[model samples]
Target: MFLAILASNIRLVSHWSESRGVYDDICYLRQAHLFQRFGWHGLDTSLAHETDGYLAGKLRSIDFPNWNEPTRAPCHTEIADGSKWVMTPPPGTGFVLALFPEGFQVIPLYALANVMIGGFALYGLWRAREAGSLTLAALFGALSITFMINPAKASYSMAPTMVVCALAGLVTARLFVDEGRRRLMMIAAVGILLGLSASFRIANVILSAGYFLFFGLSFLIWRTRETFVAGLTLGLAFLVGLLPVFAANLVNSGHPLVSAYGGQDTAAPHLDPAVLRAYLRDTQFPLMVIACAWTALLWRFANHAGVRQLTLLVGANLALNLAFFATHPVFTPYYIIPILMLSLWTLLFAAVFTRGPVQGFDRAPPGRPRPPEMLSRV
Candidate 1:
């Protein structure tokens, strides 16, 4: 399954690059190069130059053809007295791309690595299932692969799919790892992964809010010093991971929280709530509504503390995203793909934990309870 996904991703990306149809990928590459050269401050100095080069050359190239087509040009907006260009997308994807060298191999390498991460995550989920049903696990694994092959969701060197995969891995680890200093370490790693995902897409910070809420609830419900320490460590690790992004933003825009698109009309009322609802229905991403239903239905069966908490966090993240996007003036099918992927993974998690214990699956070391029991103990 992993090899198939990896091969498919590599093939897809091998054909796509800066020369293809105009997309957010080039902006990511440009930002990556800038960051590599002079860091965040370099972005302020290089945005205009990068944008001009892309617009006059790469944008015009339009599939690297001989004739330049002006009609199909991408609509880009400039800011800071035309010194900076906003791609109108999150910088998290750019940051990820920045980690690799700018070459044909970069995309394939990223694709391969992401596939491995996702495969590991899905394998962990399958192993964590208490039902001990290989059939069910295989089905969910198939679902993951199906989602992964969708170019709009996964092929593009963007943040959404990457974020979903990271979040899913975090939740999977939470479900499987036994409570101890090791669990604390895993939690901290999860926090860092969450932070890294958010760096690609700032709105992902809402997930951090959901996670923190769960941690707080765990402290209240479980009242264990381990839980408290784990929560603190996770939060601190996430914040530390985010420092680079904060610094980059501060250097670029003079405000840590402000993005390149922050100056644009983001909160103005553009569509009626009814219209937004219609759009969401069309996009098949009625996240807030579906989350409410899933949360209600899944809560009673969730055996592990981690599963229950993750269920709530996933729902909260969905609700937050729904509310946020509802107010925005624009809508795109791709915008909701991440939310859908997240919803599916969370549902899978619920399925794994709620299956009740199978004979072989439920056992731990002799005379010891399962990991879920440890989670229950706080």
Candidate 2:
């Protein structure tokens, strides 16, 4: 499965040219060019700094209207003094591309990503040691690898976002299943992954909504110092991982927290029949249905309290993500893919998924009142 997916991704990306129909690709490449040339100072993506004509050439390649005008470029929005125009998406995607030499970035970027995700699939295979479990794992792994090409290919930022979602999914399973000193470490790791995802696509932060809900509920219901510290650690780690985006925001928008995106991208979401139809017509919707169905099935018949909690988290994440995008005015081919992928991956590795002993949160003796604080000790 790994080799097949790797070869497919390599062949697909091999034919891909730097200049394509997507204008967003050009902006991402231009951002990479800026970073490659200016180092950390490249965070300021003002058009005035385009002294080399690289951005112009990329724009002209696509025959973009008014290629010479910086403000007219797609995905580049004007901010502050009508001079500093920047791409709405954060610089992480560009920064990843900037790591490679010019004219040889995209293929390598995607190839390496295939390796990472494939390795993850293999890890899932290893985790499912039984025949029935292994068959389910194998099918899910194949679908996951195949998914890397469909909706995952709609945008360059999605490459990194997909990788982050897969890793976070695995860690999320551990977050619910594993009990002991490693729990705090896993929480921090998940937090860092969540924040790092935002650097690729600002909306990717929504990927953490489920974790936020789960952690919040656990703390509120249990009211324990452990849960409190866990939630605090997750929040702080996310801020730390989000530093690059904060730096970019500070450099581009003149505010660390304020986003550079404006116009339709930031407009308040409202129901649109056309947008709704588009989602239903796309592969994203079916993937979402599968995720929701799997969550519901697990919620109904799961044997372990840990798996139940994980399922609940998956449910919350799905509900929040779907609600946000369903009402969004603009629709994209891959907008909701990340959340769907995240939910699927988390479900695949759910701890105590098989029928067995229900050893989860230790219970208080029947004669004594059960302490609510024991809920998230895992």
Q: What is the lDDT of residue 165 in candidate 2?
A: 92
Error of 2 at 127 (Å): 1.3
The sequence of per-residue lDDT tens digits that candidate 1 reaches over residues 1-378 is 645665666676566555556555555655566666666544442344453454446545555343243223342355556555445444556555666776553455456555654664566456564445355555545545544445344334443444455465446435442455477667777677667666666655655665677778878999999779878988998887677667666656667776656655555755567757656576345544655676666666666675666667677766766666676666655555555556655565556545645534534678775687555654
The Cα RMSD in angstroms, rounded to one decimal, for candidate 1 relative to the true structure is: 6.3
Cα lDDT tens digits, model 2, 280-370, are 9998888888899989998897777888888988999999999998997799998999999889888888832443323465546788865
What local lDDT score does residue 5 receive in model 2, on the 0 to 100 scale? Answer: 73
The residue-level lDDT of candidate 2 at 337 comes to: 90
Cα deviation in Å at residue 338, candidate 2? 0.3
